[model samples]
Target: MAQRILVIGRSPGVILDAAERLRGKGFRADATNQFDDVLTDYDTATVDVVVFGGMVPPDSKRQLRDEISKVNGHVTFVQGLAGIAGLIVAQVESVTSAAGDDTGVEYDAAERTVRLTLRQPAQVVVEAWWATSFTPPEPASTSTRVVDSRFDPGEHVVPLPAEVPAVASFVTVSVGPAVHTFTVGAMPDAVRRMASTSALPPVRAVATHTYG
Candidate 1:
């Protein structure tokens, strides 16, 4: 059977647009503006993924999430925010607002494309950002150098003193039921390394449901 997807939100245009995008990618996409009605439908349908169009109201968002969890154990949720400030707080399962100061980065391993969102009201050189992969060479040194002809000509090596020391640029943010966090440091290099090493799989489709 085709993968089933539920899109929940008040905006039909955004919800339908997302549903179309999912359909193009070979998913069985369906959408509903009535949040309450969608939840009832999901109880009977086998939904594989869920995508919320915008920020869900706090009460409704929480209630729907609780209901869905009782039925679907591992339903992946994607909250689409509008701006940077909105994105920052949107790590919660149901909040979707605007993508503000912080840039939103999405990596599609299957498509091999990394999508980035730079919010307005801030001026920063996004092109200056870099990402790379790192692995311990023989006789692991306390420091490693990262070279990128595009950004820095001289080898730009940083110290990796610990066995998996967290990079300063990366910060933890909680999303969903788990305390999920994502890093923003050196994404380009990390993507390349992950692609080459087969460490991460292509991002799977997100699932959503509506409740009355």
Candidate 2:
């Protein structure tokens, strides 16, 4: 079952944006910027993870934590250090890995490489999304390149797929329920360096289908 998360913070935009991204990742999520409403919401709803945004007040945060802990001693609490959706998602994934189901993935953008420590056999997919518009929060336009594979259990290192469009913003590495996103700054040059690796799988330029 998907863990239900409650996102509360003083920053409305940040919490709302985090909630949207959490939902996109398939987690059951709810958000509120009002500190006063958090207790009521948490008490009345089924929340497995309670995330406090970066800008939440210290006093209110402490009080809420104390009260929530009393109600559900086993619930997990995540202190958000940033407003980045990917980072927030990573934080949530970190706490929910009690069963060792995590993929243990790492992405190095400078070298354009992905390292995976798989606990079991699973399907893996890599995607590069190019930003067509320099808009904030969400892209106004985008294109994607994808590479897919069925990986065996153990450690594996794969080079980032070549030809990440001349305007790519980042790469998303997905394995089962795990998602790792890394931003590769600047375009053509980064793509050229990433493409130099002598890897086998080729990335499909469009989102139409996945490459083996």
Q: Each model's C-alpha lDDT?
A: 0.40, 0.62
Model 1 lDDT, residue 143, Cα? 21
Mind giving the per-residue lDDT tens digits that candidate 2 earns over 1-212?
87788877544445666677778877777777666667754552357898886445567778888888877867888886344455566667656644435678887766777788988998887766554542222223343546688999999887755666434456667787565666564444533332233442332121100100
Which one wins on TM-score? Answer: 2
Q: What is the clash tally of candidate 1?
A: 30
lDDT score, candidate 1: 0.40
Model 2: how far is 36 from its true place, Å?
Answer: 3.6
Badly placed stretches (over 4 Å) of model 2 are: 24-26, 97-114, 125-149, 152-154, 158-174, 179-212
Model 1 Cα lDDT, one tens digit per residue, 11-45: 44445555666566456767665656666555523
Q: In model 2, what are the clashing residue pairs, if there are any?
A: none
Clash totals for all models, in order? 30, 0
